[model samples]
Target: MLEIRGLHAWYGDSHVLHGLAMDIPRGRVVSLLGRNGAGKSATMRTIMGLLGKATGEINCNGVNLLKLRPDQIARKGIALCPEDRGIFPSLTVTENLFLPPVVAAGGMDIASIYALFPNIRERGASRGTQLSGGEQQMLAIARILRTGARLLLLDEPTEGLAPVIVQQIARVIREIKELGYTVLLVEQKAHFVESLADIHYLIENGTIVDRLESAEFAASRDRVERLLAV
Candidate 1:
């Protein structure tokens, strides 16, 4: 559903993402695994057109994402849930959920989103500041699901969360995959991605160093660990 080639991005004079290339098939969960400075989040920003200076092809289906503005790219059915879950401190959970405009057809209704995130449903009247980190993360994901975005760019969804919350996040991704949404996952934890991602692309110094299907992961476990180690 998504294809990227020769992608390079810059923030003012600082350059990042050195000719990165990867593909995400429709309805599949693909992961980019890398260290802190490995350009994982940069790639996500570039794809979403949030990066200022980017060159190269970011094709979604037949549409050229590089030519479109961030809002336009979103209207074409792509959504980014950044590492920091962007919830409004003053808004209630229900208000936050209804804030983003629906960009396309076939978005999940409030009932469906509520069903997927029962915790959120239970706390519909609570302000964002009243929620726990896990609840906030769930709301972030839920907010985008209402936008009818087919391709989800989840940047480090599991970062800094407790083990149980991480598992819940994983489960949510799995459920969305089963529902036919394509996902581009950026994560540092290979273990967190093991059972969820269909393909894993290891990145180093802003480029792809290796690609592994889920089947090859068992054999490449040690190599993946070494590369991820600080």
Candidate 2:
């Protein structure tokens, strides 16, 4: 569903991605794993057209996303839940979720999103700032869901959540996969990826260093740990 080839991105004069290439198959969850500053988030930003300068081919479902604006890329069925969750602190949960529906094709109904995230449903009236980290994460995902986007670019969705909430998020990811959505997951949590992802791509210094199937990834624990350790 998503193809990135020879991708390079820079923030001002600082180069962050260098010839990174990877493909995410339709309806599969592909995890991008790396330690801090290894360009995982940079790749995500470039894919979402958030970077100021980028060079490469980013094709999503047959369209070239590199030539499009961020909103245009999003309109092509990609929704990003950024590393920081990007919740609007002033808006209530429902409002924050409904805000992105204006730009999307098939708008997601509140009930379905509420069903996917019961916690957010329970705190439907709470402002973004009033939520816990996990709640904020849920809000972020739910907000993306409301956009009716089929491909999700999730950057560190489990970053600061409690273990229980992380598990819940993992389950939700699995559910989304079952529902036929493609997910490009950037995460530091290897264990969670072990159970959720179909394939793994290890990136370092802005390039893809290794690509492994889930079974191969499971068997290379030591290598995975070495690459991810700071």
Candidate 3:
């Protein structure tokens, strides 16, 4: 549902993304995969309009995302769950989770969220600062799902968490996809992305240098792995 071409992004004088290109069709999971210094996070930030300057085209469905403000971008059914932050620190989990009122027509209700991720409900009383990283990540996903956004730009959802929590996050991602949500994921974990991604883009230095379908990736992970070996 999103299309990007020749994308260029900058952080003031520092040019981070160079002619990056990506295409995300509806109801599928796509990933941007690379080493730590690659521009995966920068690409996501540019799409969400969080950066001060970026160029080229970012179209969600038929709308040109470049023309819209950040809040307007969200209202148009896109959500960015960043690597470092996702929730309002001052609010309780319950408040941060449901504060954004439903905008479009397909959001999950409170009961539905509790159903999909009971972890969130169990920690409802905890402040955003009090929840663990995994809980905050889940809360971030829940908050976006509550907004009726069909496309999720999830950046490193499994980073820094324990393996069990990573598995839990994976399960949640699969469930969300099953429920008809599309995802644009940024991650360094090749195996993790391999499990859930339909297509994968290998980014380097500021642009996508290669791409692999899941089968190709599975059969040839070693090649990609070596490229990311640092």
TM per candidate: 0.98, 0.96, 0.95
For residues 1-230, could you state the per-residue lDDT of candidate 1 as single tens digits? 88889988998888998998999999999999998899998999998899999998988878879999999998888999999888898999999999999997888898889889999989999999999999999999999999999999999998889999999999999999999999999998989999899999999998999999999998998999999998
CA lDDT scores, all candidates in order: 0.92, 0.89, 0.88
Estimate the overall C-alpha local distance difference test score of candidate 1: 0.92
For candidate 3, lDDT tens digit of each residue in 1-230? 98999899899999999998889989899988889879988888888899889989998877878788888888878888888756899999989987987876788888989998898888899899998888888898899899988899999999999999999999999998998899998888899999899999999999998889888988879978976888
lDDT of 2 by residue, 1-230 (tens): 88899999999999999999999999999999999999998998888899999998987767878899998987788888998888899999878877776466765677777788888878989998999999999888888888878889999999878899998999899998998888999987788899899999999999999999998987887898999998
Q: What C-alpha lDDT, on a 0 to 100 scale, does residue 184 get in candidate 2?
A: 93
Pairs with backbone N, CA or C atoms under 3 Å apart (clashes), candidate 3: 1-25
Q: After best superposition, candidate 1 residue 205: deviation in angstroms?
A: 1.1
Model 3 alpha-carbon drift over 4 Å, by segment: none
Worst 10 residues of 3 by lDDT: 97-106
Best-to-worst ranking by TM-score: 1, 2, 3
Give the lowest summed-lDDT range of ten residues in model 2.
Answer: 100-109
Question: Pick by TM-score: which candidate is best?
Answer: 1
In model 1, which range of ten residues has the least summed lDDT? 55-64
Pitting candidate 1 against candidate 2, the one with the higher lDDT is 1
